[model samples]
Target: MLLHRLRAPAVLLALALTALPAVAQTPMEDPLDARDARRVDRMEKVVRELRDIVFKAQRTGAPVVVQPADTDARMAELGARISDLEQSLTRINGSLETTGHELELAKRENEALKVQVKDLTDRLAVAEKAVAPPEPPEPPAEEPARAATPQEAFTAARQLMLSGDYAAAEQAFAAYVQDYPEGPRIAEARYWWGKTLTVRNAHAQAATAYIGAIRGWPQTSWAPDAVVELARSLVALKKPTDACQALAELPKRYPKAPTTVTNRAAATRTQAKCAA
Candidate 1:
């Protein structure tokens, strides 16, 4: 009976030892806890004491000693693996942070480059406008057909002047003077040209045309009128003395002038404040 009790205790202790190795070899999802480790150490110490008691009861002179459970070695290996995992996670996190910072910097640089490109484009446009050539002026419109003869040209020019087409009349009369320098109506054309110039407030040019028309005091019907116009132009030019001089010659040069010419000469002299 005594041997049986001792054997029963030994068998129970052996079963506990076998079960402990199986539990230690089992894979765990989580790290070992301090409390669970302490409990396992107590269990191993109890199993060792029980084994020693069983051997003593069998009359063995030597005390049996057990090596430490594999659980401690496995726990140490699990701790190292957890530490490695933490380090890897830290490295991964650092890499992600660095990449994110680089991305932000790149984005900022890209935006700045975009702004610079736009500025350059704007400047290029302005430079192109500055250097670009101006558009050519439009061509002059077609003019009226030329008159067949000097008489026809002079008549056309006179008709233009009477019709209030002063721009056309000025061009026509100028053409008449060029085409017929010695034409019969040259003096009359010149006088009408001066009238057009005076209408446009071109007193300086009108004076020149009037002087040309009355050269040598021709006895034509327009001569006295031309002389009066010359004096009027000189008055407009602020040359009162020259105006008076022109008016003084109207009577001496053209004694047969009409009453209208005499009246105009008197008025011009008064305007010039001429010496009586």
Candidate 2:
């Protein structure tokens, strides 16, 4: 009986083990339900990790990683980026257009200024040519005067002496004496003019002129001419001895003058001849 109880227990343990396998073998509609539940738990864990990463990024001021769930959401994000790019491009294009327009206006103004400067330069050249002054005419050339001859000058001097223009006549006679002291007419002119000056009471000047003619024209034909006149002037000056000496030298200087020899020999015969 004890043995039968023991066998009954063993049989019951085997039957329980056997019934568990049979239940496990039976088919069910939710075959992977537990696996699905585990998969859902793993997905929940990944979501929690992503949330933590996003929180950390926020704290550090960094960008969050996000995934779009649908095409509409992705398309909307792309459209926003495209709109921002278009706005930037529009501003850049507007600035470029404004700069180009300003450059074009400057070019036009510069060209207009160039044309105006050229016109002003041309007008200035024309005005300078039109208002220019004419040159002055040159002056005519002149000829020099001729010099006078000696004979003409001598004739004019004799005429002045005869006219009693004593001062002018003295200058002319002095010039003639300087120019032609040995000429034929010089002794006669000097002797007669000295006598005329003595008669005019110019005794000293008359004596000087007579002495010059006697000393300078000693070899000329007027030697005895000046000698006789000088003797007369010395007598008038109360120089009788000097007058006698001058009278003695006349025949020696002009030996061929018979009149001079006769007059001198007669004058030397008596001291009263000086007074005569």
Best by lDDT: 1
Per-residue C-alpha lDDT of model 1 across residues 49-112, encoded as one tens digit per residue:
6655666655754444444557987998999999999999999999999999999999999999
Candidate 2 lDDT, 175-267, residue by residue in tens: 666677776667655665675577667767787888866765467665666677677667767777887887777667777766754575566
**lDDT score at residue 260, model 1, on the 0-100 scale:** 86
For candidate 1, what is the total of clashing residue pairs?
0
Alpha carbon lDDT of each predicted model? 0.85, 0.66
Clashes of 2: 0
Candidate 2 vs. true structure, TM-score: 0.36
Clash counts for the predictions, in order: 0, 0
- After superposition of all CA atoms, the RMSD between model 1 and the true structure is 15.0
**TM-score for each candidate, following the candidate numbering:** 0.48, 0.36
lDDT, candidate 2, residue 214?
70
TM-score leader: 1
- Poorest stretch of ten by lDDT in candidate 2: 1-10
